[model samples]
Target: MMLTRRTITRGPFFWLSVSSGIVIMAFILLPLIQLFVAPSVEMLRVSIQDKDVAHSIWLSIYTAALAALISFFFGTPLAYLLARHDFKGKRIVEGIIDLPIAIPHPVVGIAILGVAGKNHVFGQLLAELGIRVMGSVTGIVTVLTFVALPFYLDAAKAGFEAVSPRLEKVSRSLGASMFSTFFRITFPLAWRSMLVGLIMSSARAIGEFGAVVIVAYHPMIAPVLIYERFEAYGLKYSQPVAVWLVLISLILFFLLRILTLRKTVEQ
Candidate 1:
């Protein structure tokens, strides 16, 4: 009778959803919680002070920022077009943009290697320009750009979609050029989503490891550094670096949530 009454009050679907969400949240939060507590404060302090650890973290941030900037400049026009126009094969273009997220990270590394190889025309061109994509900072940045692009593109497209096109048309009808209208109207309205996307893309780039390790193992980023430390000296050495990465990632996630909430409220 009590179970039936409760189900009648809110429905079984509601109860099931609540339970499922609790389970998923626990699964996600448990490991991070354990990791945060596992390292001694002294160990974390020592890791923070380590020059290599510091360098690796800085490298990760630097490369991710570069990748984000590249995506912003190269992707914005495409993102805007996708949001505002309809054309043949547009879905195909979107699928290609999103393909990176679906492919395996190591496979991504190998594919990059093939394109950047000395025998390939594109690779030869890069070589002629004195750009080495293997075992260099350039390789790391390239790998990050490949892996992180889709997030920025998706966020940008969604943001632009949220903006009403009637306003843009009205601006153009009032004697504004397409460029002026885009910057003053469409872009201003969509900047929040673009900014969120940029940070999210950078955050994704910061956590990349498998491809970077396969390409540029030197000048290591934080994730690759964490892996190397774990392999060489075990968790005692790796945990501290992981702690710092998690802390930084958490901050990014928090900002994403705040922006997401604001976007929702605006809608």
Candidate 2:
């Protein structure tokens, strides 16, 4: 009688768990499965061969990589400070850091243009330096970096926060210099999270469209090119590029995962 009653209670819970699992799997996995099934191999090949498509893909990769590098170089130190230090306006500063993530991309582009366009004071300074942001690679990278910075910063900050300050205190007590202790201890400990942040930033930069379009629509990235194709030739033409982009991005995603795993293991 006890076994029967227990089985009755567990049965509904088991089915509910199965249903929740199915919903999550369907939500995440179905779209990816469709992306593969929707495009023909020949269509994907042709898309890759298309000159404009090829250019967009290459540009996307180049710009995304550059943005990620910039984020890592500048963000690492800032992340450590934010994670380790407490000061006035700290909350405000953190909120500002996250503003990019919350604001609309088009709005970000508009803001960048307002501050950095040739006529504005900052923009005029840049103009004097013979650097134009209106319709150039600089503009694209600017927008990409602006939009993607928060990802790296936030992830790195979290990673740094997770490291016990006691460890640093102990290292200091042992007579190691601050710089030496950071290099030997803190950096190695937070390296994996930094890598994760970089991967996320790169992915965000690569997929950026609204801001890139508003900033520089000429030297198209894959997302822009995909949009243009859809506008010009409709779904049939665009789907090939879409499929190609998805496949290429997925490959990159996996490579980053492997890199992250290797880095994690090494540390």
Give RMSD (Å) of candidate 1 vs. truth. Answer: 3.1
Instruction: Give each model a TM-score.
Output: 0.93, 0.88
Question: Residue 37 error for model 1, in Å?
Answer: 0.7
lDDT of 1 by residue, 31-70 (tens): 8899999999999999989999999988988999999999
Whole-model Cα lDDT of every candidate shown, in order: 0.92, 0.88
Clashing pairs in 2: none
**Which candidate number has the best TM-score?**
1
Which candidate's lDDT is highest? 1
Model 2: CA > 4 A from native: 1-17, 20-24, 255-267
Clashing pairs counted in every model = 0, 0
